[model samples]
Target chain A: MKKSDIIKLLILIIAVSLNVKTMKSMHANQAEINPDRAKISGKPVASFHKFWADVKWMMFIQHMGSIDLTTESNSKDLYQEAKDILDLDPGFYKVYELSALMLSAKTPDLAIDLLKRGQETHQNKNDWRLYSMAGNIRHQETFFNKKVNKREKLREAIGFYRLALKKPGVMPVLEKTYIKTRAQEAHEANNDVPLVIAELLEWDKYVNTKMAGSEYGMEGEGGDMFLSLEENTKKDILSLIQRVKREHQNNLAGKKTSKAMLASLFKGIHTCNSCYNEYGAGHKFCTDCSKPVKVYGICPNSQCRKTHSNGKFCEHCGTNVKPKKKKK
Target chain B: MDETFAIASSLWKRLLGVRVVYFLTICAVSLIAITNMYDILMIGESRALMVDTGMMLTTIAAMLTVISLAFDIPKELQSGIASVLLAKPLGRTHYLMGKLIGVSWVGIFITSLISIGFVVIYSMSHGAPPAGLVKALFLIVISVIPMASIVLFFSSFLNEAVAATISTVFIWVGYSLASLNGVTLFDLSLFSMGAEAFYNYEIPPSYLLKGVVSALLTAISIVCVTSFIFNKRDLQ
Candidate 1:
């Protein structure tokens, strides 16, 4: 070939190569850079995954340049970028909702993370909905990670359930009951016996009774019935109560040696059960009377709502109840 | 008077007749109308006013240069008018150079008028065009140099009507394709890749490579082919 023809061929080759290289670099960068992962593990896993994902996402953006996402050609990249965002902040609720709706199983972690993060930040009714969604994902993970000693994972899930309980707004009573029950199981498995028993009793008295006719009640189909806690924590609580009663009998019989033991027993049981039930069981019960608390009004369902010296039934809901008053 | 200047004056008078004025008026009106529409719709970025004005200058310059050059040599050849013009005391190169210079001057005038009108109207409707408007206008004017040469080369042999009409349409289409790197083809290939990857991993298209490469190729082709065609063609 002549020198001029060779030069022309070289130019064409160079142009094609450059275009290909540009596209390849973009793809490589997108794959490498993701948003920073929620530093779930140690520093190395957090930093390495985050750095790698971020670099990939940045390169993808650079490769894409200024594309309008509304166009059909640009929509794919837009969706991918959104997935990357969810990967970085899995607790980002909106991102999870969008990714789940759009990409589904391809970005399940993102969807779960989006809901988790939404629960963490907003603390609103919507945030509770997201929290419940995250709980569903955690439930699935719990089932899947059966072989993986998931103590820490369960703890994290418990945190989200607690957030859902604290969130303002009306939730389906069954859903709220379900969240409280799961939280009780998490606490019991983690060695919170008193909390486990207290939550069991609370659920027995309130949720189980209210849900008696519904699918959410302990007697209903798939009703947890606090069965999981009954098998483990109930035994523990019974032993503790027997020990406390024996120590108290010794104190009443003028055995001064067991007086301190009785006081310690009472304090330990009260502290353990209160902390465990309130924080771990996911119930916002009153500290004084140990009744379920309500927002915006004194508990109308409590016996304290009546004008009598010691009413036996709640004036509002007409149920047998105690009359002691307590503040949140 | 200098022979070059005298030749330029006569050529200018011939080219900028009533029809040329009408064409320029239509171009100016269209430009203002488009700018008004852009302003009313608010369909662009913060620098839109400046960019639009710059685009208007470039469009007018391109239209004037291509129309004038495509007609200059062809009209002279068709009317048996070259003999009368060639009998004058000017070299062939000088006559050609003078005609190009006159055309360029008219192009510059049209560009300036449209650019100024855009800025003034934009200022009245919105605020002043950005501070970079002048620099943008200068860049646009400089960019049209290759376009002017293209029409001039085509005019040397083709008839005025045919050269003007064909080259105008062709140059616009070529510029668009070259700038965007055959967007239609790129999108068609993307579709064949299947929907999942297309929706999840596709990158946005950029024109840095397409614009530079296509412009270079078109410029070289025009220069080489124009030289070859001009040298062999009868100048009747």
Candidate 2:
């Protein structure tokens, strides 16, 4: 061999050595992050790992079409097939979702396990559906899994909803379900009025934020839906406060506390002194309490006579509309 | 070096013009198109299915294009084409290097064409593919270098049939070892971004850098080894 060829060989040796070292480290790095690859025996080898996962997904869909979902044996078979598919490609999001949903019918615990596995997988950590669905399964397990403590399952479901709420882009329907579940839990287990009110307000804030961030002049029907939802939530808050105030009216200090809470929820609405029912602008009496109430912010001009919410001047006629202070 | 480039361009044109390469590419494109029909079957996962199938088909087509040279090399040598070419101003090392560069160029070009078709089809069915998928396709292009060099290494010393078989077996073993996490000198699986794309996981830039470096170094080393072996063999 020529001397030049000798030098080439030497360089090749060094290059190969470097490549082997890099590959070994690469393998080690992947091992650290790669969850244990599914170990199903006899799976055919393909050029790409995900390709087989795709094929298995097709087979799974075909099997899904043939099975009767209500049958216990069919559920078990479906779960096993899902497990195998997940073992090959743990990142298959729909597999985790559909399988967990179906498996929960017969095996709630296994469904939770699958969703929890999905949650642990890095790709799924931010996906809100898995967490919320897991919560739903746990919540319903009160009836399905007789061994579970009802209160404990409810608390677990609430906890899952909280996690789901933190993720961006949660569906409005899921939020509705979450709030209802929280209220039901509070009513049955704890009757913690303050906590329940706080959760309802949190949902209110989430809806408001979503509304605020929507594209200007482009919210379309979405804006109207949000507005309606906001209105309903505010009414709920008002009713809850009213119930508390009525319960506390016998004690002077408790009545004062309830009044303060009610004032915080509504900026300037007139409250009936006799029964604490809220009345609108220009109303002579509270609608529910049927007691005379003071009115404010009526336009001074008899011609305009518009009632403003709370302003020194009427918005319609620019006339000063502040109510005169009563002489003590 | 000019002679090397001359030989490379000529061989590249020859390989690119081969009917078999076009046939393989058409097969891949048609199969990828058929994968869209599997939409009803995949339930919400049809996008993932199509993406995985498109990438796999691209890899196979590109690899087959480069590996064709494994058979072509021995035929050229037996036909005394290498001898006639080496009789000129070209060095044996240049001849081998030229072939490697030419085959790798064809592999990358064909892979890119199919990838464009895939991205279009994928976009039509399911919005634009994630950036990770594009990166994954790019990795497949980078992979052709080492693959072409592996074929050259085997074809240098062995007959066409044996050379193609060993080259294929070596690549298959590399992928199998990857599944087992076994260390290898040239790990082809490092170039795969299929799982990342399927899961919509962002591949770290550091990993991408490492993969590109590893593939290039492996290709360079293998080509040098082939050159050494080819230099000692008698052309007659």
Q: Model 2 over residues A262-304: C-alpha lDDT tens digits?
A: 5655665667777667777888888887878897657779999
Which pairs in model 2 have colliding backbones? none
Runs in model 2 lying further than 4 Å from the true structure: A1-5, A21-47, A144-147, A171-231, A241-261, A270-278, A288-311, A315-318, A323-328, B2-10, B34-39, B77-91, B122-131, B182-184, B197-212, B227-236
RMSD of every prediction: 18.8, 6.7
Ten-residue segment with the worst summed lDDT in candidate 2 chain A? A215-224
lDDT, residue A38, model 1: 20
Give the TM-scores of the predictions, in the order they appear: 0.37, 0.79
DockQ of each: 0.04, 0.46
Q: Could you give candidate 2's per-residue lDDT for residues B146-232 as a string of tens digits?
A: 888999999998999999999888776665666665558867777776776666666667677777788888988988888878887
Against the unseen true structure, what C-alpha lDDT does each candidate score? 0.45, 0.75
CA-RMSD of model 2: 6.7
